[model samples]
Target: MTAPGSIEPTDLSPLAWRLLRIAAGYEQRAVERELDDILQAHISMLESGSRALSNRRRQTLLELYAAELSPEQVTAIVEHF
Candidate 1:
Protein backbone atom coordinates (compact mmCIF):
# COMPACT_ATOMS: atom_id res chain seq x y z
CA MET A 1 0.00 0.00 0.00
CA THR A 2 2.74 2.37 -0.79
CA ALA A 3 1.61 5.44 -2.66
CA PRO A 4 3.13 6.25 -5.98
CA GLY A 5 6.84 7.12 -5.59
CA SER A 6 6.76 6.11 -1.93
CA ILE A 7 9.53 4.09 -0.38
CA GLU A 8 9.06 0.36 -0.02
CA PRO A 9 10.38 -2.10 2.58
CA THR A 10 12.86 -3.42 0.06
CA ASP A 11 14.17 0.09 -0.58
CA LEU A 12 17.58 -0.91 0.72
CA SER A 13 19.46 -4.11 1.31
CA PRO A 14 17.83 -5.10 4.60
CA LEU A 15 18.63 -8.78 4.23
CA ALA A 16 22.07 -8.28 5.74
CA TRP A 17 20.60 -6.44 8.65
CA ARG A 18 17.94 -9.08 9.11
CA LEU A 19 20.53 -11.84 8.94
CA LEU A 20 22.71 -10.14 11.52
CA ARG A 21 19.75 -9.61 13.81
CA ILE A 22 18.82 -13.28 13.50
CA ALA A 23 22.38 -14.36 14.13
CA ALA A 24 22.73 -12.05 17.09
CA GLY A 25 19.54 -13.43 18.59
CA TYR A 26 20.13 -17.08 17.73
CA GLU A 27 23.35 -18.86 16.78
CA GLN A 28 26.10 -16.70 15.30
CA ARG A 29 28.64 -19.51 15.13
CA ALA A 30 26.41 -21.85 13.17
CA VAL A 31 25.72 -19.24 10.53
CA GLU A 32 29.41 -18.39 10.24
CA ARG A 33 30.48 -21.98 9.85
CA GLU A 34 28.81 -22.64 6.50
CA LEU A 35 31.55 -23.50 4.06
CA ASP A 36 31.71 -21.14 1.03
CA ASP A 37 28.97 -19.17 2.69
CA ILE A 38 29.99 -15.81 4.02
CA LEU A 39 28.55 -14.64 7.32
CA GLN A 40 29.03 -11.48 9.39
CA ALA A 41 31.92 -10.36 7.26
CA HIS A 42 29.71 -10.80 4.20
CA ILE A 43 27.43 -8.11 5.50
CA SER A 44 30.39 -5.83 5.91
CA MET A 45 31.59 -6.57 2.42
CA LEU A 46 28.11 -5.91 0.97
CA GLU A 47 27.67 -2.67 2.86
CA SER A 48 31.14 -1.64 1.74
CA GLY A 49 30.37 -2.68 -1.86
CA SER A 50 33.41 -4.96 -1.94
CA ARG A 51 31.52 -7.99 -3.22
CA ALA A 52 28.67 -8.49 -5.62
CA LEU A 53 26.38 -11.53 -5.42
CA SER A 54 24.75 -13.86 -7.89
CA ASN A 55 20.98 -13.82 -8.41
CA ARG A 56 20.58 -17.21 -6.76
CA ARG A 57 22.53 -16.05 -3.75
CA ARG A 58 20.28 -13.05 -3.42
CA GLN A 59 17.14 -15.19 -3.45
CA THR A 60 18.75 -17.71 -1.12
CA LEU A 61 19.48 -14.94 1.34
CA LEU A 62 15.94 -13.67 1.15
CA GLU A 63 14.62 -17.17 1.69
CA LEU A 64 17.09 -17.91 4.48
CA TYR A 65 16.23 -14.71 6.32
CA ALA A 66 12.51 -15.15 5.71
CA ALA A 67 12.30 -11.44 5.13
CA GLU A 68 9.08 -9.87 3.88
CA LEU A 69 10.29 -7.70 1.10
CA SER A 70 8.04 -7.36 -1.93
CA PRO A 71 8.86 -9.03 -5.24
CA GLU A 72 9.54 -5.59 -6.70
CA GLN A 73 11.97 -4.80 -3.94
CA VAL A 74 13.60 -8.18 -4.30
CA THR A 75 14.10 -7.72 -8.04
CA ALA A 76 15.36 -4.18 -7.54
CA ILE A 77 17.99 -5.20 -5.01
CA VAL A 78 18.96 -8.27 -7.01
CA GLU A 79 19.45 -6.14 -10.10
CA HIS A 80 21.08 -3.32 -8.23
CA PHE A 81 23.81 -5.23 -6.40
Candidate 2:
Protein backbone atom coordinates (compact mmCIF):
# COMPACT_ATOMS: atom_id res chain seq x y z
CA MET A 1 0.00 0.00 0.00
CA THR A 2 1.06 3.58 -0.53
CA ALA A 3 2.06 5.68 2.44
CA PRO A 4 1.49 9.37 3.00
CA GLY A 5 3.47 11.33 0.40
CA SER A 6 4.33 8.11 -1.47
CA ILE A 7 4.02 8.04 -5.23
CA GLU A 8 1.55 5.81 -6.99
CA PRO A 9 2.55 3.21 -9.57
CA THR A 10 0.82 5.03 -12.38
CA ASP A 11 3.28 7.88 -12.47
CA LEU A 12 3.29 8.69 -16.15
CA SER A 13 4.48 5.59 -17.95
CA PRO A 14 6.59 5.90 -21.10
CA LEU A 15 3.42 5.74 -23.14
CA ALA A 16 2.10 8.74 -21.26
CA TRP A 17 5.31 10.58 -21.93
CA ARG A 18 4.95 9.92 -25.61
CA LEU A 19 1.36 11.02 -25.55
CA LEU A 20 2.25 14.17 -23.66
CA ARG A 21 4.85 15.05 -26.21
CA ILE A 22 2.33 14.58 -28.95
CA ALA A 23 -0.21 16.64 -27.11
CA ALA A 24 2.17 19.46 -26.41
CA GLY A 25 1.63 20.99 -29.80
CA TYR A 26 -2.10 21.21 -29.29
CA GLU A 27 -3.99 23.68 -27.16
CA GLN A 28 -3.92 23.13 -23.41
CA ARG A 29 -7.64 22.57 -23.15
CA ALA A 30 -7.50 19.76 -25.71
CA VAL A 31 -4.94 17.90 -23.68
CA GLU A 32 -6.88 18.49 -20.49
CA ARG A 33 -10.00 17.16 -22.14
CA GLU A 34 -8.14 14.08 -23.29
CA LEU A 35 -6.38 13.63 -19.98
CA ASP A 36 -9.35 14.09 -17.67
CA ASP A 37 -8.56 17.61 -16.49
CA ILE A 38 -5.06 16.78 -15.29
CA LEU A 39 -3.02 19.93 -15.58
CA GLN A 40 -0.08 19.83 -17.97
CA ALA A 41 2.21 21.13 -15.27
CA HIS A 42 1.32 18.17 -13.09
CA ILE A 43 2.08 15.85 -15.95
CA SER A 44 5.38 17.59 -16.51
CA MET A 45 6.25 17.29 -12.85
CA LEU A 46 5.23 13.65 -12.76
CA GLU A 47 7.35 12.92 -15.82
CA SER A 48 10.31 14.56 -14.17
CA GLY A 49 9.81 12.42 -11.03
CA SER A 50 9.22 15.47 -8.87
CA ARG A 51 5.59 14.72 -8.03
CA ALA A 52 3.37 11.75 -7.22
CA LEU A 53 0.57 10.25 -9.22
CA SER A 54 -2.45 9.82 -7.01
CA ASN A 55 -4.86 6.88 -7.25
CA ARG A 56 -7.70 9.13 -8.38
CA ARG A 57 -5.46 10.67 -11.03
CA ARG A 58 -4.45 7.25 -12.22
CA GLN A 59 -8.06 6.13 -12.49
CA THR A 60 -8.98 9.31 -14.31
CA LEU A 61 -6.15 8.80 -16.74
CA LEU A 62 -7.15 5.22 -17.43
CA GLU A 63 -10.72 6.21 -18.01
CA LEU A 64 -9.71 9.06 -20.31
CA TYR A 65 -7.41 6.91 -22.40
CA ALA A 66 -9.88 4.04 -22.59
CA ALA A 67 -12.55 6.45 -23.69
CA GLU A 68 -10.45 8.47 -26.13
CA LEU A 69 -7.98 6.04 -27.63
CA SER A 70 -8.38 2.51 -28.84
CA PRO A 71 -6.96 -0.40 -26.81
CA GLU A 72 -4.81 -1.47 -29.74
CA GLN A 73 -3.43 2.04 -30.09
CA VAL A 74 -2.59 2.16 -26.42
CA THR A 75 -0.86 -1.22 -26.67
CA ALA A 76 1.11 -0.17 -29.71
CA ILE A 77 2.24 3.06 -28.09
CA VAL A 78 3.20 1.21 -24.92
CA GLU A 79 5.11 -1.39 -26.90
CA HIS A 80 6.83 1.02 -29.25
CA PHE A 81 7.56 4.00 -27.05
Best by TM-score: 2
**Per-model TM-score on C-alpha atoms:** 0.38, 0.53
- Give candidate 2's TM-score: 0.53
In order, what lDDT does every prediction score? 0.46, 0.53
Candidate 1 lDDT, 1-81, residue by residue in tens = 333133332333645444433533434454456424757666455545576555455444445443345445534444453
| Global Cα lDDT for candidate 1 | 0.46
lDDT of 1 at 22: 55
lDDT of 2 by residue, 1-81 (tens): 222123333644744654644533434355566675588776666556677667687655545544555556544444444
* Superposed model 1: Cα runs more than 4 Å off: 1-30, 34-36, 67-81
C-alpha root-mean-square deviation, each candidate: 7.7, 7.5
Error of 1 at 3 (Å): 16
